[model samples]
Target chain A: MNIAILGFGTIGSGVYEIVNQIQAEELKDCKVTKILDLPQNKDKLDIIVCDINDITEDESIDLVVETMGGIHPAYEFIQNCLQHKKHVVTANKAVVAAHMSDFLKSAKENGVQFRFEASTGGGIPWLASIQKAKRIDEISSFYGIFNGTTNYILDSMNTLNEEFETALKKAQQLGYAEANPSADIDGYDVQNKVTISAALAFDSKIDMKDFPCFSMANITYEDIQYLKSHHQMIKYIGQAIKKENMYEAFVMPMVFASNSLEANIPSNFNIVTLNGNTIGELKFYGQGAGKLPTANAIVEDILDIKNQISYGKVSLDKKLSYCNTLLKEKYLIRTNCPIENEWIDSVECKGANYYITTKAISTKDFMKLVNSISDQKAMIAKYM
Target chain B: MNIAILGFGTIGSGVYEIVNQIQAEELKDCKVTKILDLPQNKDKLDIIVCDINDITEDESIDLVVETMGGIHPAYEFIQNCLQHKKHVVTANKAVVAAHMSDFLKSAKENGVQFRFEASTGGGIPWLASIQKAKRIDEISSFYGIFNGTTNYILDSMNTLNEEFETALKKAQQLGYAEANPSADIDGYDVQNKVTISAALAFDSKIDMKDFPCFSMANITYEDIQYLKSHHQMIKYIGQAIKKENMYEAFVMPMVFASNSLEANIPSNFNIVTLNGNTIGELKFYGQGAGKLPTANAIVEDILDIKNQISYGKVSLDKKLSYCNTLLKEKYLIRTNCPIENEWIDSVECKGANYYITTKAISTKDFMKLVNSISDQKAMIAKYM
Candidate 1:
């Protein structure tokens, strides 16, 4: 089987190396025949193609792996490949999150498989596990540290008592975060992952924009110290819970007990969890994002296709509505203007900051209250 | 597809419940047609069969789920079913650990699948995950808390300051341990699981008895307290590492940092890890053994067969020998007898007990020295 990789970048080059180096019977006949990238980025002379049609038009190429890491041309190219009856495997979460339903529909109509195991949790076999689990169990909820960059920053702040910006800069130096790191630190990366996970786990179509995401960019050193003093530490998490026919999905910085699993997740590692009816709660922990790890997941999907191992079909037929008001939890609010509220359980004043602990309140209500305030520097975290 | 259950126990009943309750497209036509058990244990009159031939001879029964926990008849019955070209799914660790290679051989000859996902980490999708990982990466080593009963005992001893016997009794009351409790406390259960895991991970046949297993039964409350004071906690773990042409595998009580993931694994929960070439380290945490959880795994295998999803073939053709002297670590020894050796780093006498810490020494050397002593009450643990 001939394979083509879109974008000869970090993950794409790693995929090419693994496809050529792995000694597996199923992957023995598999070869990277074409690479879609700019002329200057070409490492191999024989297989470089700047146009998508050059590879899509070739009937010999049976599979396409997308590592382009964008939504625009990657999504259109994936749709074209599926329409051509070619199997598609991707590590792009943004495209999968935005066009999952459309891609599934196209793949179904074309009788091909569209897999994105690397789209969430990096090297962790999370999507395949969830698909297997859904065969015999009902997945009611899932939540975890989906972004490695924010996790690194938060973990560093807690352990080394470093400021948020200092930790983020360190993460940037280590290549864990990009120079323009708003997608990761501001919770957009986690939002995309949460959308993909919820779609697969709950069998429902979810819009990434519909889910409210609270940024971890505003978390300060004082907040981490205060939470640590209270036997808790902060972790940026993307969580989705199913309540009857409604679903509540969001991304926020949450406080966990110092000794809990979430707090103990050090460095840039991630821990994702799923609550099943029969299997109970199962957690998958590993490197959330990296070149080789992410490439390993993409190769796994390729092998699955080669061995005729189908994860069945991607069907989001479950009619579940989104409602953040269905879930309620206590919140830790740090702001300059918080004087009176019935939900306020306790309040502490430190210099110019009013740190208030609110009683159990709906996420929708809390976000509404926070948005009503003109203080853009206010930071809110959930109590886990 | 008609299915036959070879036991009417905890896991067998769970498989039946999930197979009937799961609303999946692939399992729509799958039904439990026969159940082999004694007449006194019959819960359903229409499907119960006392003889093995009642299941093997039935041409309509295409699959057999062996939940009968033993080596004798369970092993023989599984072989018979495979000889009859029936796919077999089992949760019996003892049978799988002892006759895994033989069962794989028989299943291959008859063109059938022999799966034991629940034999290692119950409901955690451990074996399946390992198989998927092996398709693309070289697994070098794996280790974790494979036994929940022993973990519960050790955790309770550390957290509640309960004696070993008291914790064992608590485990029994919660149905986590059997009446004998010998298999769990003596590390035989973990040994069996490690054997099965190593066979699948390294593609080599291993004997459960060949690997050394240290009993956690001798651990005392004072040992837990001493370790706690040093910022460590005891956890019973089964580990296997590949070193070129040889492999080192063992079951022993090891100390981990207090804030580590292993130390915080409370209650009867289990955590297993695998180290892959590309995926780095991935940890799976969940209930290792339970009625519904184990059964859920069995049903997952059954569904795989129904959907024509294969884990391919199992071939333990890797010519790897077992050796224990290649790995080295420090040891904490507490005994009534005086110990003197070049490896000893420090020693302190507390009444009639001698608490000694040894420098890095191979497990083979430490065990040989411990066995040379006539004192049967001596306790030793490895420092991680």
Candidate 2:
């Protein structure tokens, strides 16, 4: 089958190499017919085509792989490919987070498959593995450390006892984080991933704009030290727990006991755990983001399509509203300005700043209180 | 579909409970038609049948569930069911380890599927996950902490600073260990699991008798403390690493740095890691053994069959010769009588016993050296 790759960048080139190098039956006889890239970037590669129409207009191209990560053209290109009766696989989390339902509907209508295994949790096969179990087991909830860049920075900070700035610079130097690292450090990357995961896991569309994401930018060495002193390790987590009949999805810093798996997740490795009612907590751990790892996940989707495995039933039938106020939880809050509040049941003054661990309170209410407190050094983390 | 269950014990009854409790579409119309058991064991369960012919002769029985744990009758029973053109799903590791190739051959000849997800890693869905990746990636090797009973005992011994016998007694009290704990304590259980995993992961039959298995019974508090002093933690590991053209499969104690993931695996949790060529290290972790967890895995297999997801092509095409002489590795050995050996590069006399850590040596040669020094009191562990 002839396949075209959009954006011959890191992940795109990796996919091309794997399809050419791997002798497995799933990838055998498969050829990359065209690689859509910028005209100025095109060089010795004969398959590189600047025009997107070269791929969408080609009738021989049975599949299109999109590695160009953005919502605009990637979404349009993927939608066009699905409409043109060509199967589509993508590693773009933004497009998937925003337009998954539309893509699924278009693919189903056009008698094609739409797979985005690489979109979330990079190489971890998070969505596809969960989908397999979803065929029989009802997933209650899932939580994950989805962003590799942020995780890398956090791990560096803890391991080297360096502050957040040093760690971020190191991650940037290592190509783990972009120069403008707001997407990762500000928690938007993790938000997009968890939103996509929530959509598939709960069979609902969680709008990216609607989901509240808490950033790790404010996470300080003092906070980490305080957590360490309390025998807890801080991790930026994306959790989607079903309470009553609604789903509560959020991205925030949560502290787990020192011995817990979440606390011990080292370096940039990603761990997404689905709590299935029958299957228990099944975890998928691996390199969450990398060129070849993400490319490998994309290939898995291609093989799934090749083997005539129908994209398991997914729908935006229920628009799940993000609700974090369902259950009460213990929280660790550090603020320099907080002098009085009913939520602050207990407070320990570690120097000038107060380290307060509140009683079990709804996350929404507590976060609201946290948001209201405006100080240079105010930070909040949950004790889950 | 009418299903017959052989051996209505812990896992069998748990399977029955799940099939009855879960209202999944795949198990909707499925009914337990007959349950085979010993004459004296037959009681209030109305579906119990004394004669094996009751299940084998029933043409309406479309599937058979085997939870009978043994090599003799369970293996024969599964082969007979396959010959009768009935799909079989088993939780019996002994049977699967011994006759996996034969069962697969029989299933292929009779146009039936043989699945034993419960046999290897209890509830982790390990083999199924690996098979999914094997479709697209070439896996090189895998290692796992497979047996929960032994893990529980080891964890207890380490955490509570208890002796081996005390930990064993506690494991027994918790129903994790059997009265005849030889299978688990002797490392035979891990051997059986790794053998089955090797057959699937490598597409070759790994005979239990051919593989070398080192038991946990020889491990003492002193051994644990000695390893701890060196910033290492001891774990019983079943490893199958491929080198050149052969596979080296063994069950033994291995030491990892204190901060490594293997060292942090707490309680009875199981971790199985597979190294794929492109995907890097993928890990599956969950409750590896329990009545309900094992039963849940069986139900997963049943659903796979119902969905017609062919048990991904597995072949005992080549009988893998176990050879541990492929690569050289570091080892820590404690012996009552060991003074002269060229391989021993470092020695520390902890007490009356000599703690000798050897330089890199092939596993086969190292084990041979260990065997020679044994007054049945020598303990050896690999440093990985």
Candidate 3:
């Protein structure tokens, strides 16, 4: 089978190495015919082509791999490839989360496969497993540490007792976090991942714009200390709880017991848990992002396509309403301003910040409380 | 598709309920044509039949589910079904581990699929994930807590400070253990599971009788306390490390740090970790065995077969040699007959028993040492 790789970046290079260098049996017959990248990368490889038409116009290219992350040209290129009756495998979470429905429809109409196993949990094979489970069991809920960059930073702060800036720098030095780390620390990365996962786990079209996500930047050293004193650790989690016909999806920092699996997940590793009606709760853990890990997932999709494995049409019957108001949960609020409410429990002082553990309140009420107390540099972390 | 049930026990009944009452889309067309059981169960259900010929003679029965869990008539029945070009799904790990190669050959010759997702790791979707990963990357090694009953017993002994007998009784009371607990406590259960997993993960046929396993019954309360003082916890693990073309498979008590994922798995929960060439370390955790969880996995296999998902013929290229002499590991040995050894770091007395932590040595030498001191009732647990 002839293939083309779009974007000669880290993941693309890794995929090329696996397909060409590793030469595993599953990919032995696959040959990379073209690699589309910037003209400057042409001198570095013999197969590099600057024009996207070189790939899409070539009818011999049976498949295309898109490691080029972004919503613009990558989506356009993949759409063109699918329209030309070529299967596409991608590691681009942004594109998958944004235009999954359109891509699925195009693939079906063109008689091609559109698979993005690397979009959610990297090499963990999470999304594919959830898809398999969904065939027989109803997944009621799933939540996990989706982003590895923020997890590394949080773990560094917890273990090394370093401030957020120092931990973030350490993560950057280790190449776990990017220079422009807002996508991870600000929760946009996790939002995209959870949206993509929800689409497959719930068999619905989940739009990222409709989901609400809270960043990990709100967690302070004082808040960590407060949680430590209470024998808890803060973990950024993307939770999706299914109810009736609608689902509640959000990304936030939740407190897990010190001895819990979520608390002890070391460094940049990811752990995801899916709750099925008959299967109970199933958890998967692995490196969420890296060159080889993400490449391995993309290769898995390529092999599945080569073996004629394809997923059935998703239901899209259930609506994914990003509402968290119906469920009541206890909250730990840390702020400088004095908060007065009957639901608030006793307050404690750690350094200059005051911490209060509130009684169970609807998530809608908690978000409203946070918005109202924004003047005090307040942060709310829910209990897991 | 018409289906036949080989056994109407716990797992069999659960599968019936899922196919009948739940009525998921994947199983909507499946009709339970006949249920084979004793004549005593005939009054409870009109489909119950004591004769095996009733199922094998029925040409309309396209699929057969075997939850009988033993090697006797269950194996013969499944063999007959495959011979008749009927697909078979089983939850019997013992049968899968013992006669996997035979079943695979039979299925291939008859143009039928033999699926056993429920055979290992219960509803965690472990075997299926490993199969998916094997397509893209070579698995180097894997180890995990495979048995829920023994884990529950060990957890009870650690947290509640209960004796072995008390924990055994508690496990039996909760229905996690059988009245004849010898199979589970003797480590044969885990040995069977790991053998099956090794066959799939490495694409090699592994025999359970050739693999060495140490039971939890050998671990005493005093041994647990000694390990606890060293900031470690004992977990019954089925570990398989790959080297060259040979793999060393064993089920034994391995000590892990208290904060490790394997150690933090509480009660009847199960966790397995696999190290792949490109994916690094991947972990899976969930309920290893339960009526619903096991049933759910069986249903998953049924759906996959219905959708024509077939596994490639596994390559048994590598030889599975039972040799542990070359692999070095630290062992915690408890004995009264130990006088001197260069590998022993130090000896400490806990109550009337003497404990020693040995430096790294080949597993072969450690087992030899244990065998020489058999008169002293010695126990050895390796460090993870």
Model 3 C-alpha lDDT per residue in residues A1-384, reported as the tens digit of each score? 898999988999998888888857777899888999998778998999999888989999999999999999988999999999999999999999899999989998999999999999998888877877777778889999999999998888888888888999988999988898899998989999999899888888887777567778878776777788888899999988778677788888899998799999999999999998888999999999999999999888888788876545655667666666757888888888878877787788876677888889977777777777854457778889
Give DockQ: model 1: 0.74
Whole-model Cα lDDT of every candidate shown, in order: 0.89, 0.84, 0.86
User: What lDDT score goes with residue A362 in model 3?
Assistant: 79
Question: Any runs in candidate 2 off by more than 4 Å, and if so which?
Answer: B41-43, B336-338
TM-score of 3: 0.97
RMSD to truth, every model = 1.7, 1.9, 1.7
| Cα TM-score per model | 0.97, 0.96, 0.97
- Model 2 has a DockQ score of 0.66
Q: lDDT: which candidate is best?
A: 1
Looking at chain B only, the TM-scores across the models are 0.97, 0.96, 0.97
- Candidate 1's residue-wise lDDT over A1-384, tens digit each? 899999988999899989987787767899999999997766565788888999889999999999999898999999999999899999999999999999999988998889999999999888888888887778899999898888999989988989998999999999999999999988889999999999998888987777788988888999988887888888999999998889999899898998788888889999999999999989999999999999999998998888889766768988888887898899988898965877789999877898888889997778777777677888888988
lDDT: worst 10-residue window of model 3 chain B: B309-318
Model 1: per-residue Cα lDDT over B302-337, one tens digit each: 888777786656779989888878888898888988
TM-score of chain A of each: 0.97, 0.97, 0.97
Fraction of native A-B contacts kept, per candidate: 0.80, 0.65, 0.87
